[model samples]
Target: MIPKLAILRRSGLLTLALGVFFLYQSLKLELGSWNEPGPGLWPLLLSLLVLTASFVLLIGNSEGGAGSEKKPFAALLRDSRLPLAAIASLVLFIVLSRYAGLTLAGGIMLLAWLRLLGKEKWTTSIVVAAGLTALCHVLFAVALQVPLPEDWLLALWSAGR
Candidate 1:
């Protein structure tokens, strides 16, 4: 049988650490009245939940028998490329958006990501990128009243209007 103790130990440690961190953050925030929800309420509740779960896992592990070999770290590393690339692209998008405008920056980031990570066809990438860029433009600019960076191209286009 698989070792319950090993699972419990790992899960408990993670939970305990997360619980402490959340509790610290919650204490730092203004909790306000119980009648109306405050910023600190969610984190306080989550921390309590984590603490309880960690204790349960620790107790269960003590009662269960340990079994099986540990999985290789290489197995975890195998499928990380896509996430790494996506994170890098997101960072790049943030940097580029300051100069290139949200529409252009977001469009390029989406195209590159879809093409590189998703291995999407050019037509599909173009369509998806354009659609997403347009959606963001409408949402942030029109609906949310948040102004996007005006790049040279966008500035020229707006000047003509």
Candidate 2:
């Protein structure tokens, strides 16, 4: 079993790779001027943010850091809970988005992380998740005119109309 710090380093590396992939994918799409942002602009910015964050994580937890020492098996297991939860949540988000759409999936994931992982109050978690989801919707779908994964709820509503 890998030590906690090694796991963190590997995760950082994985994130860095993902960031690079996203950046490349985003660059394939048209990147319009700032005043007239294209569909790819938001994704480009997000990918850049991911790259920056992953680099920070990698540098902060480098081999020489205090957390680099090998920990006991039990301690390593305990320390891995957060990272496992994050990975699980990411999987959940991907699967859920395919069925429920990005807005709902994002909201659910955020709520779970904030409430269960972060130990935040239910009300606070719900509010923050909802707010963030709404903000994302407005920014991506409304303002930037980016096409998101088809939303089941919206489809149902449209069918009903």
Candidate 3:
């Protein structure tokens, strides 16, 4: 296996290349003036951010400061449990959202993440999750009128009515 530093450098290079690709694609899109921002502006800005961060990561890890030793891939996976869990939970949320709608899926995701990953107390996690779910529902569904997908529960309720 490659050294951790080498892995990081390679990842940084990959990210930098992706950012450059995104920058090129975004530039090809129609970017309106500063006052009337077009579809491309947001992507362009995000690509720039990615480019900058990858550049910084590459520069910072150029020399061995810390965590530069070679370790097995298994060890790397073992050390990244939290991040892996977060990613897994995010994927779960995405799958759940398709069926459960944003509100319910977001609530479940928040509760699980706060309680399991964040190690928050049950009451605190439940309360915060519910609150955030409500806030998100109001923000996107009510205020922004985002036309979220119809939840199975909502469909059942309407059917019963």
Q: lDDT of all the models against the reference?
A: 0.73, 0.82, 0.78
Shift in Å, residue 8, candidate 3: 0.8
Q: What TM-score quantifies how close candidate 3 is to the native fold?
A: 0.55
At residue 3, what lDDT does model 3 achieve? 71
**Residue 116 of model 2, lDDT score:** 84
TM-score of model 1 (CA atoms):
0.50
Put down candidate 3 lDDT per residue, 1-161, tens digits, no spaces: 77766766676677699789989999999999899999899989988987996777577667654767533332433332454466578779989998788777888999999998888999999999999987887798789998989886556656999
Alpha-carbon RMSD, each predicted model: 8.3, 5.9, 6.1
Ranking by TM-score: 2, 3, 1
- The Cα error of candidate 2 at residue 92, in Å, is 5.6
Candidate 1: tens digits of C-alpha lDDT, residues 1-161 = 53544544665676678778879999888787789878998779878987886666555445424673433432332333454476578779879888777778889999998899888999999999999988887888889998556765567778999
Structural RMSD, model 2: 5.9
| Pairwise lDDT winner, candidates 1 and 2 | 2
Q: TM-score of predicted model 2?
A: 0.60
lDDT of 2 by residue, 1-161 (tens): 77767877776788799889989999999989899999899889988988997887677666665556643332433454675587689889989999899988999999999998888999999999999988998899899999888997667766999
Which pairs of residues clash in candidate 2, taking residues 3 or more apart in a chain or in different chains? Answer: none
